[model samples]
Target: MSNITWSFADRVVAITGSAIGMGEGAVETFAAAGASVYGLDVDAKRGRAVAERTGSTFVECDVTSSAAVLAAFEQIATRHQRLDVLINNAGGFWEQNTTESISEIEWDHVIDLNLKGVFLCARHAIPLLRQSSAGRIITISSLAGQTAIYQSSPAYAAAKAGVLSLTRVLASELGADGITSNAIAPSAVLTERIKVVRSAEERAATAASIPLGRYGGVDDLVTWMMFLASEEGGYMTGETIAVNGGRFMS
Candidate 1:
């Protein structure tokens, strides 16, 4: 991602789950545009390496813990003294279980990571975000949040649904403060995780099922994310933009 100097020069961004996958894509995208990013993830070494490549700072954050989230944001604020954007991109599939058999422990774990994680980060980031001239919050969600469930557990779907709802509520609450909150709900994206987890035949089958006859790439969502984080996207708020390659039209 070659940078455009005019787009994101000197912007302050904090993104979670940035050690890999779509989160990594965002880190690179923002950095390419000249933003100084605070990349947060569980993998300290990999996160730092990625940040080094982009001239970003690395923060080890367990998004589910409020204390960790607070500390991480405080550290970012201390260094940059401002936060212009935040992407709550943590959370993913937990265990394979339906409502009938999903244990309470598993449910709580996923919810805390997915929904509570976003809440905690946003709850703490508000003050710093408000200090910026253009504050933006983009939460990474999924089609599961708006549609029926599938490969993911019920807890994942429910938590993402909560994120979608929270997007709307936060937009309403913070629009007056010059902050915008939005979500990206994606489907079958192509990543190392997906390639390693699914066999070729299974992956091909899923791709064929999509209307585009292919799985989504990280670049697909990165484009939309850039828009949401850009001045052009200033008018967009409380939007749950679906980037599923027409797999599920919403």
Candidate 2:
């Protein structure tokens, strides 16, 4: 986040869950790089604020709804005609619980938002992405996807694992079309949701355990995303880059 410079002058980038947290960070990052950024989220108020700050387009879209996703892409296509990058950053953890304690409703809710949402966005954006010369699809996963090294809802872990599989599948299927798909698995990032869910003492303890001596931040994830979307990342596909500061290595 220092002396960083990357120019994506005419690239069109779309980010899900762009209202806050890592998604918002991405919007700001791409906008600064001169990309035509589009922010998608169900929270219109916050999304609009992000758009105002970054000068990106804000679209009200619920990632879980196929119709909403389709309409949003239609709007993007109408404006940009082509999409260079798609970041599936919209995800959530329903609650902290084990299999026996987790309800079927909770499982479905978590899976739908975290995993299904990624599928829906990719499904709609593939056509637009194919129109670009260097298309990049970056999905935000979690260290929980690799191993059970952190305390998270069982549903969260399962959904993120599914995301990793989906990313690889997309890379394999879309490679012939000159598209690249990748996943970023981060651990203990300090986003708005994390600040609300974990206490200060808990966060300090978690940071102490990390080999980097601090928890990851939104900028760290965004920087990786920028690289994956850059021309230098053209040859990369079906890879999962871990950004946990050595919390879990696989």
Candidate 3:
């Protein structure tokens, strides 16, 4: 993907939301890098297929459920005593509603998936991470969380913002154990879900708005993830990297 090369040999990596999009890409990337990879998702069929194609293990897990998350980690612990990296990559919102227009169910689903899921995974992953010399928690946040350039789901935005906060707290709490926690906030990555949500005209308009003059590819984000999970990224923690192609610069 990027010019930078990484070697994850002997590393044990676990990825959430591995059925599609960024999570799927992370599974493939890490596995190719020689890491023992495990892909977790609610979509058992697609998840199993991805694992088979990439030579990684697959675990059917609903991240929103504590019991499911615990069982998934238990399986990982049984297979590998420690975890090197945990990629929290499962989150999405179907509805783009205003604060008042959003329903309770919609809000809870978005918040639970985007925010609560991160918390649960981090909570469970900490023990395994502590067992590793260089443990990492790399979360996939969103540009919408930082700011709303367009109309978007209120719950999704709020939940993503919450992820940023949680990432920092995890970093602070786990830094003593030599574990680093960080996040990536990406914008306008043209995944299958994005393509379905935005029409051609809307996509073009978004591209024109970005200084980069195009939507981001999966590689762009995956490459950042690689860096965050590498030895070179060991010193950095409690920070969020914004990879939005100059769309929102702070």
List per-prediction Cα lDDT, in the order shown: 0.89, 0.93, 0.92
lDDT of 3: 0.92
Using lDDT as the measure, name the better of candidate 1 and candidate 3. Answer: 3
Angstrom error of the Cα, residue 11, model 3: value is 0.5
Give the poorly placed runs of model 1, Cα more than 4 Å off. 2-6
Candidate 2: where are CA atoms >4 Å away? 1-3
lDDT of 1 by residue, 1-250 (tens): 5233347888999999998888888899898888988988988988988998878889999999988999999998888888999999987874667899899999999999999999999999999989999999999999888888567789999998999999999999999999999999998888778888889998998899899899998888887888888777888899999999788886
Q: List the residue pairs that clash in candidate 1.
A: none
Where does the lowest 10-residue lDDT sum fall in candidate 2? 1-10
lDDT of 1 at 148: 86
Comparing 2 and 3 on lDDT, the stronger one: 2
What's the true lDDT of residue 137 in model 2? 98
The deviation in Å at residue 40 for candidate 1 is: 0.8
Model 3, span 84-117: residue lDDT tens: 9999999989788998899999999999999999
Candidate 2 at 238: error in angstroms?
0.2
